[model samples]
Target: MDKQIGYGRWKAPADVMARAMARMRERERAGGPRKAVIGSGKEALAEAIRRYPNDPLRQLAMFLDASPLPALIGRAREVSAKTRTNHGDMLRGAIGDLKAINMKVQRLDQLNRRQVMALAAYWTHEKGQTPGTVANKLSALRKFFTQVGRQDVVPKREALYEALAVTGVSQQMVTRQQVALDTKAWTPKGVVPLEVIEEVRETYPHEALLMELMLAWGLRVSEALGLRPHSSDTPNFLLVHRETKGGRWRKVPYMKDAQKAAYQRDVLNRCRQWAEKSRRLEMGYPKLTLQQARSRLYNVMAEIGVTLEQRGVVCHGLRHEFAGDMFFDITRHRPPSENGADSDWYKQNKTLVADAYQQVSEALGHWRREISSAYLGSPTKMSKAQRERMEQSMQLIAGNPDVKQGLVAAGVEQFWITGPAADGVLLRAGEAMQVAGRFQEGWTAENLKQVHEVLRAGVARPIQFVVSLEAQPQGETLEIFLDR
Candidate 1:
């Protein structure tokens, strides 16, 4: 039988209109029409009915099965590849968390703000996750939703903020408290003791040289493995030419002091012996990948009765120990005494301590002194006057035309004069802010001497300066322009 539909047009009698109205009413009752499901319902129904003209139930089922999470998760994997760390693991964990909450959500648009908060609470209490971890997971989910153009699914920051403020709620809901925990207890713990090193040496004799490099020079496992000796005029010093994690080709000197030079020479000799031994045994050079090296080191450490996990330490602890030792050696200040009188030296030589940290940071292939704090504990705070003096010195050197001309002649386009030292000036250069050559800050005769020395040292680029005002008169005689 044919029925008269819109404008007296004859159409087959079917319950399509009734089914669509029922679906819309069900959605409206559930909460409200999902933005994706609103206009999509009619289109889906029409497409299904057109494809399966003889089946009415198939049309209804097809309209109800639409989901967006699976596609969004696929897109998330693509995004994770661009990150330095593995974000896929985090996403997988987030998915597991969603499943635990029994939201059974197929589409991102299905979950409301309240449901999201419930998941947060579940992670905080049932899963016993830290505030930072919870925040990070939520942030990852938020980023995913935003990328997939379903940002409305992400709970509002205000809602999360209010949830955190409520008392007697789940631990995860206390976001402010968790944030405080992150700030106060975010310090890295990596300081391997000497006894543990000895035990490791005994367990893995072949890796002794590598361990020594990490302890003495603070070399990462990769850096130590990639090292090859280079010929230099300074026989005592080992010329290490390697690409650091920061993507800079650095020429770091391994033997900077008499003690370090002696230790490094011994280690080099020992390495040669090990290579010769391996060749004799026909066991190829003891070359290892970074993971292999870390595994071997960890295995040896575990056998030595050292609980690295309990101590909150890792293979990098040797590097931390080196940084701490170097800081103390350079500053000649021990850890603060109970009465705090032992730190008086730090107050007296705040600039020197800062400079030492800067040097240590560079030695570790890092650009920032603040990072050194993780290894060598936090440095003593500097006074306003001390900071001003350092700034003044840098300005004095930068204001000198001769100094600027010297750098420009060396082909350096732009540079930052960090601070002044007794022997030279500390500076960072280029758009990357790499540590450039240290230029001497002194009297006219001394300054000219340093310029020649710097040029001889192959610093063909412009070098930043940090001179003192006391040397200004002598600097003026060098026909230098002193602007501003």
Candidate 2:
């Protein structure tokens, strides 16, 4: 029976949903072991059958009878598609003699996108799937789908690529690994100013230290919350070991003054409380879970005028900053972007960003050298002289009194012209917004709307302005550029 006779929705045949349910029920009638796992799996499988408009038996058989490699690969692919990590080995371990292929496909096809994405999230977040496991599964699935010749089974390759394209996966699996390697790195560092931490502290004193630790050390909120005085007794270092992402152990060495202070005082106190509550003094870490710490940190970071624009200032920014700082230190005296050439660390370490690429690789914990090498390339860096010239140009532009008055007088009107820098002054103007005559033609309402869209998407956070006011005299010559 054609499931999609009229409507697009697939309505399963009568036996499709009932097949698994019937089998489970028969097992129950025979006084089989009543296990929650079996029940849940059956229920889920049955539900999938009911939702999909296909023959379950035929699909399961098709999946089961294929050679071990293809079958293992196909199942692994399904797992990877459902979870964004690698689990080829686990998939192999879970594989059993295929008595039914048609049934498996029927059940799998019945699964909705939400179900698939959830399973994927759990696999990576809960089960700790490796990149290799994920890659093999993806490879297996690609082969299975290509061989199967089902339009529905053939996934959106682009989306699959996006989901599986971890830093190194592209290099090994995809044909355009080199091209992908050429792209700029998006390390997990934020660009929050050092002063912003002090400002946030003045407003919310309690969270000030926490904010500083996150920005300075790049410790995840959970790790920060679970900090301990006893475990972190080192004068210049704090030891961190937390179970996140499937109970994996990640140890971070902390070396910031703010972090050291927090460890001695507030953080140590919290750890004692947690230890008492859990009735375990063996591990003297704070009891606060990562989720709790992350939430509080998010709110605090937001209040401190932190935006995504400063790429190395967010919670994850600390690690990126650490890596970047090391990179700068290693290559400071040498000319820029010479990762592949002879240098101090490269000379001694016998490593090049283009060759061994050890710095970024070790920082990122990537398994492959190719993954770390991706960070070695940078097309955005300007020459030192060019950078100085750009700074001078900005100063020259900033020095013009008319430009300043125009920016200030226009207030909010000038905001769309210059983004957040003009926001504070514009807000003060309120209804008295007055844009300069020069902007009368350029700063149209349509243009402002477009600018807002660009600002919102480009910055990855809300806008903030540092406004300034100054005195200006009449008959001041205004030199306005057409670009403005």
Candidate 3:
């Protein structure tokens, strides 16, 4: 039996040492049992168990017992040297040019623990060694021991060389509200008033008109920059087809007087100048790089004493303004209702209003109603007076007998108007003549047939019609025929 103390200064009895040696020998013969080593520290244990499973105590005792200390020391020295070559080489090379300045591993071993710590401190503080560098060096040292054939001395671990990261104190995240256009976020504040538009027009006469267009239309800087003279020739409509931020192509329309004028003159001139000066391309082909135009616009605004913190308006703001104004107008002019139903023109002409929204969506290149509604904000309730007016309009359109006769004269095959007619009757029209084009045109046989189909379909808003002498010259009443 061998008498030896374990690594942690624990002494093993002679009998225990004998048993451990036997187990170590068994491990060597059969190889390490799967359970002997597991988890992170298992690898080194596995190797040791595999090498001397049956004689583990004898092997372990060699390190602990002074009688066998000389032999164990020699073995350790050999293993350490081998490890130094492989792991140490890799780590030394990783330091790159710094290797020349550092002591070799052999020298490192001669230094005391305090000396080693001081050296590490110097590398970090003086040389600015990054965490990654420390991690790499640690990995190399661990690898060296395992590779040097002294695997028994090394601990088995998966994350043995991983750096312990220092975490900073964290606080709760608080969201900040967005600042306005004229806020410090933007360079030029108050750049979008009418006066600024006038200044741009006067200063850059060639591009003056186009600046006005941008002020009126909520176009992107790039779209405005790309304006050409030919754009003015295409009626009052502006065709916008371009690739935006997410690399998606969109086609929308710009329909405003200011937009039309700006594109014709000022915008065209600048585009022409860019073509001639920068790209040396044909002046007839108008296009601007996305960055340059935005920069130019900001510079102009700055020169005009626009502050970044207030009133900075971008081309996109124009769209918001337009949508906001339109939404207000529609709500303001809405007629009233007679029934208890709170009168809202949108509610009254739900389908037609929906159609109008759809048209706007198409114009804005939006695929959803909710997205379009951003400009409308939340709907407001109407007053009783407004409701009464809506009811009157509904009744007038509902009870017009002239409409029914007209539908008949126009040869309407079949038509229907849901709910009660002007006289509080349901299914007002049996068959009516079609009304072609605008309601202003006189009804024809074709017109009467179309009107019949329209009524049958059940429109959102009631159609308006005036009584004709040929049909019936009397008090207005909605005339509708329901066929059994």
Structural similarity to truth (TM-score) of each candidate: 0.40, 0.37, 0.31
C-alpha-based local distance difference test score of model 1: 0.47
Sort order, TM-score high to low:
1, 2, 3
Candidate 3: which stretches are off by over 4 Å?
A: 1-195, 206-210, 229-233, 243-288, 305-308, 312-315, 325-343, 380-484
- lDDT string for model 3 (1-484, tens) is 5655322222335576455446434433442212211132334434444555554333222212211111111111123344434543544443332333463232211223232233344445556666555444544434333333333332223222121111110111111111121111111222344565567667764344444444444444565555432322123343443322212223334433454445444543454454444243222223645566667666665665553233444435455544433332334331111111233545676765555455444445344454444443322322433334335544443465655455555554334322223322122133122222223255455664566464545433435333243343233333334222
Clashes of each: 4, 38, 72
lDDT of 3 at 37: 19
lDDT of 1 by residue, 312-427 (tens): 45556566556655665676553221111124666778798688778777677655575555554442322232345345444544555665666555444333433222112222
Worst 10 residues of 2 by lDDT: 420-429
- The TM-score, computed over Cα atoms with residue i paired to residue i, of candidate 2 is 0.37
For all predictions, the C-alpha RMSD in Å is: 25.1, 19.9, 31.7
Per-candidate Cα lDDT values, in order, are 0.47, 0.37, 0.38
Candidate 1 TM-score to native: 0.40
> Highest lDDT, which number?
1
